[model samples]
Target: MKKANLTKIILSISACVLIGFLSSFATRSSVDTWFLTLKKPFFNPPSWLFAPIWTILYILMGYSFSIIWNNKGQSRKSKEIIKNAMMLFGIQLALNAIWSILFFGLCNPFLALIEILLLWLMIFETIKAFKKVDVYASKLLIPYLVWVSFATILNGSIWFLNS
Candidate 1:
């Protein structure tokens, strides 16, 4: 790979990881304190699972986004599509972080559930936009979409049970 592409990949991954790091500030304190007191569903995964899973997901998301970002468009229309896709990517990423803040920082499962629904929608739209730019880039987001789908269910369950 060219140096430029490698740099992009690293930067992309770093940015994603940085978001995770920042979001963890909200999560770390609550996980042992507030979150532990919540009424989680029976199927809820173990606490230790979250960090590794989120780390992997963030890496994948960054790599997927890098693929879209590095693509040089062949025409005006193509460039516009790529630009739109990137914008969607940014939106979804911001939503991802916001969900963490709402749930963990504010200790509001109900609000988190609502925000996560929007996050899921944005992720779906981002996947569609990414497909227009690069099929592989879109494919890379499938795991994220699936994970967030499961998370949506989990979040709803938590809120329902606790409310």
Candidate 2:
């Protein structure tokens, strides 16, 4: 790979890892305290599973984004498409962090459920947009979408059970 592309990949991955790291601040404190008190569903995975899973997901997300970012279109329309795809990626990324804040930091699963629905939509739209730019990039986000889908169900269940 060219130095430029490698740099973009590293930066993209670092940015995603950084976001995950920062988001953990909200989660770390509550996981042992507030989250433990909640009524989780039987299917809820062990608490220790989250960190590694999230780290992997974030890495995938960043690599996928780097694919889109490095895509240099030859036409005006292609450039526009890439721009919009990147914008969607950014929006969904922000929503990802916001969900963490709402659910863990504020200790509001109900609100988090609502925000996660939007987050899911953004991820879906982002996938669609990424597909237009790079099919592989879009494919890379599939696991993230699936995981968030499961998380949405989990969040709703927790809210229903606890409320």
Candidate 1 local lDDT, 2-94, one digit each (tens):
122888889998999999899889887698899989999998999888889889998988888898889888999999998999999999999
- Runs in model 1 with CA error above 4 Å? 1-4
User: Candidate 1, TM-score vs. the true structure?
Assistant: 0.96
lDDT of 2 by residue, 74-113 (tens): 9999999989999999999999998989999999999999
Error of 2 at 154 (Å): 0.3
The TM-scores, one per candidate, come to 0.96, 0.96
Winning candidate number (TM-score): 2
Number of the top-ranking candidate, with lDDT as the measure = 2
Give the CA lDDT, 0 to 100, for residue 148 in model 2: 98
